[model samples]
Target: MKKNMGNADRIIRVIIAAIIAALYYTNVITGTLGIVLLVLAGVFVLTSLISFCPLYAPFGIKTCPMKKG
Candidate 1:
């Protein structure tokens, strides 16, 4: 798939995922909510790494800047 996420979007996702991981590891988050968030964080990292977001596909959303002709 073409990259749908812009640099800023990808960076933000990575940062958020890292924060979630830190919170979980540091015991700042626990229980079911924490588990769920951690899982979501994993997804965020994966997507950010790939610069693709499946959810954005269906909506035809693209954060990437337009390429100059």
Candidate 2:
């Protein structure tokens, strides 16, 4: 799939995921809500790593710079 996430977007996702992970591990967030957030964080990391966001596709959103033809 084409990359829809730019460098800044990817960095922001990673940072957010890290924060969620930290909260989960530190017991600041617990139980079902924490589990759900942790799962979301995993998704964020996965998307950032691939530079692609599936949800953005349907909405036609792209953060990456367009290539010159």
Candidate 3:
């Protein structure tokens, strides 16, 4: 799939993922809720690494800036 996420969007996802990981590791979040969030964080990291977000495709959203002519 083409990359629909911009650099800022990718960075934000990584930050969110890092926060989730920190909270989980620090025991600030535990059990089912934490597990679910951790999984989501993993997805965030994966998507950020690839610079693509599947959810954006069906919606026809494009966060990346277009190249100038």
Best by lDDT: 2
Name the top TM-score candidate: 2
Candidate 1 local lDDT, 1-69, one digit each (tens): 999999999999999999999999999999999999999999999999999999999999999999999
Q: How many backbone clashes does candidate 1 have?
A: 0
Over 12-66, each residue of candidate 2 has an lDDT whose tens digit, in order, gives 9999999999999999999999999999999999999999999999999999999
Shift in Å, residue 50, candidate 3:
0.8
Better of 1 and 2 by TM-score: 2
Candidate 3 clashing pairs? none
Candidate 1 lDDT trough over 10 residues, lowest sum? 9-18
Model 2 lDDT at residue 38: 100
- Give each model's clash number: 0, 0, 0
**Residue-by-residue lDDT tens digits, candidate 3, 1-69:** 899999999999999999999999999999999999999999999999998899999999989999899
Model 1 alpha-carbon miss at residue 18, Å: 0.8
Task: Give me the displacement of residue 10 in model 2, in angstroms.
Answer: 0.4
